[model samples]
Target: MKFNWMFLFTFLALTDLANAQFSSGNQFFIGANTTVSIHGLVLRPTFNNTVWSNKVLTRSPDAIVGEPTASIQQVHTFNEPTSFSGLVGLTYLTGNLNGNTEDDLQIAYFNPDEKYVTTTGSTVDKTIHFVSKNFTGFNNSFLRITATNANSVLPVTLVSFKALKEGEQAQLAWSTSDEINSDYFEVQRSAEGKIWNAIGKVQAAGDSKAERTYTFTDNSPANGQNLYRLKMVDFDGTYTHSKIVVLDFESNMMVSFYPNPLTEKLLIQADDWNEVKSVELVTKQGNVIPMNNSKAGSDPGSREYDFRKYPVGTYYIKVTRQDGGIRTQQVVKM
Candidate 1:
């Protein structure tokens, strides 16, 4: 799939030539059938006489003001759907350097997953910054970019790092863009966010322009708060650590809502009704079924429901606990 040309041109910044005296200007051209890698995308440029004369632009009227505008058309294919995020830095030498000077170069990037642009640049280095937008998903994309605009090149640009609590397990999910030499990702956990131990490792893509996702379930996550991060290792043994994410795993008190495959009635029984605030019946398609409970304003654990009029099918008993916990169980109507 090709990226929308209207959207791509709108986001990219290209310097146009002004009415300035021609000093010594040099033109650079992208040779026919030339292949180049930018960010995490691999692009192959082919000649198109209608849209472009040749994939070429001259540099160094050297002033930044006289730079010519150029757009390189290329094709990028992916095996599966993907998304992208992270910094895109361009290399520039010969500058009055400082810690603050490099810091000021930070730019915002789009997050393909979140469906909205970020508010801030988030992080920055001499070669690392932020992306322009957040994309949701794509199988194959016709990627277009101003080739000369990128500088910083990292193997992996992590889009998201999140941890979800499932009972005593910590489900860790993360994604990356343009992974070039990535070897594998190590799932590390810490209780206090200080000392860390490696629990598991997931193999990396090695080289990929398409966004890639990875998951790791820490079956032995520490009780209470569990801190997690990814140790993304490269094929050459080089590695970088992702930002830390935390998950709070609280053991839920067991509850039973019974008589599965029942004829007409259903009963909900729980050991502790103090934590269970509400009980609701939801269809397989996610629509909630209204209940006519005799004790309408009473505790959820002591409730009963009549399903005689409802269709005989599968449903779910969704229970919302007082501690902001949610539990769901499958129910069947006979």
Candidate 2:
């Protein structure tokens, strides 16, 4: 799915306030720094999580519409099948549409009978729990939160989270606009996305209305693709996991040497010749061959050596790159 934070926020900042309670169209846009916009909806900066509801049951031309006597309804389509228990730090804010009426927001499978309800107080901030199975298929299953009346408004929102890899390290970063009774964040890692193990922990900002950024680096990330998520805990011992992100890493030492069973000379080839700083040849007995110093004298990749002077036996050719990468290959010297 395309992650357009700029588009998401820009629309959030400029949409009309009248019908802003629902999503931009019929889709629920979740994940980092994302917001939903509707015509005439004005969202306060402190109240950023918003989504426009899709069309109601009456087959209206617009994606979302309201009738004075009807209940507010909409379905949020997931880009892919999403796990119900994987959503974390989920909260919502009703737009300035419904004036003084307190509405109950309910979320569940499309069946409507099976759902969780959170009543909206005078304040617009509300939390809804998604604890069912995965929401699969193209709009077959959805994020449906029903409002008591046409004016009732609720849109789900979340904090921003990101993961990036540098060298062998994985850096995790996330930001929150507000935190309530939060305890700490446990950084979890997995070779596969299913089973997770806690690797590190970072303290949260606790209860704060101000936005805060957090970062943690995994110094010992496993080889190949590594999946990471956050286990955000509350002081009450309750916790939720952040979305999973994957980081891919490969070793830097890669090179090839020809004439393995050498009769006269040895040649080396590498992707970046400039990166190959030096080369050395040594006997299987750990004795260094002094004559191999000229192997990487000037041209590193196409470097050649006259090994005819050396007696034929098992020898190891070591290649060192400028980035501290080293690799050794064995050659039989005749």
Candidate 3:
């Protein structure tokens, strides 16, 4: 994350071209880290020796050097000293900065020098001035350089997460290095591992210039081993998905009863039953009917239910654990 001042100088020299007669000096600092500033000055001669054009480039630590093809705007100028001061802003493509390391930020400018001299302060008060000699056929160009710790601003590293357990319900967690322009994080869980579905979502801290942490809890998980991943979305509609994590849970404890084509009442049971918390009766086509609920530490035994209230058909029985475990069985009401 250390700032490279030399690179900034080089980038600016190549970008700002203010006619064929201007040249800019290297950047100089003006304050402590608490209020640091960068200053660069460029002086160019007017069509005649009577007037000289000057530019003073100033930037803060958070300023971004835009693309090479960007246009420069003139903010203010001093006629006698041939100096100009203005705010420069540019937008670069996602992967164009700093050799594509996700850490490089630079702005460049080309200049032409006629007979202008540029100098920066040797101490704090980081100021630079441009002076031009009164001469004919003289012109000068200027470019300004400013830079900061690259790592402190860019978000390039990815966050990762893994699934630890799966069954009717699952648990999920993830981590990240930095987040920039991020909108939110989506938690996706899948029962088959191949087909993913959004089980839940957590809002992101959005455009953070530092490392960030995030987590999401999924209340509804599918039976058996479940797969989990994070889908990071940006405000600009861009997104990336994190690595997958898988957690497996035992399903043998599940109970199923079936005549499949039943008409009236259904039967349900759990082998060596110890305790059951809740049971859900679902039709073969996926309709759910509440069956019964028991207090914790309740004994598990054969259970029967009247389906007279429900149309004759096959159904599924689901048992849930207070600890978030689940077991399912098919039943028929005939």
Global lDDT scores for all candidate models: 0.49, 0.50, 0.43
Clashes of 3: 40
Candidate 2 or 1, higher lDDT: 2
True-structure lDDT of candidate 1: 0.49
Task: Tell me the lDDT of model 3 at 55.
Answer: 26
Candidate 1: regions farther than 4 A off: 1-156, 250-334
State the lDDT at 159 in candidate 2. Answer: 59
Q: Which residue runs of candidate 3 sit more than 4 Å off their true CA positions?
A: 1-156, 166-169, 251-334
What number of clashing residue pairs does each candidate have, in the order they appear?
19, 14, 40
Question: What lDDT is obtained when candidate 3 is compared to the true structure?
Answer: 0.43
- lDDT, candidate 1, at 310: 80
Ranking by lDDT: 2, 1, 3
Q: Model 2 Cα displacement at 123 (Å)?
A: 19
Q: Please, what are the lDDT tens digits per residue for candidate 3 over residues 85-167?
A: 22222323232233322133222222222211222221111122111122223332334332222223212335445444444
Residue range 285-305, candidate 1, lDDT tens digits: 335554536342245655567
The RMSD (Cα, Å) of candidate 1 is 18.9
Model 2 RMSD in Å is 20.9
State which candidate, 1 or 3, has the greater TM-score.
1
Q: Which tens-of-lDDT digit does each residue in 260-315 have in candidate 2? A: 88798877777786787667665533444543444552345566778878886667
TM-score of each: 0.34, 0.34, 0.33
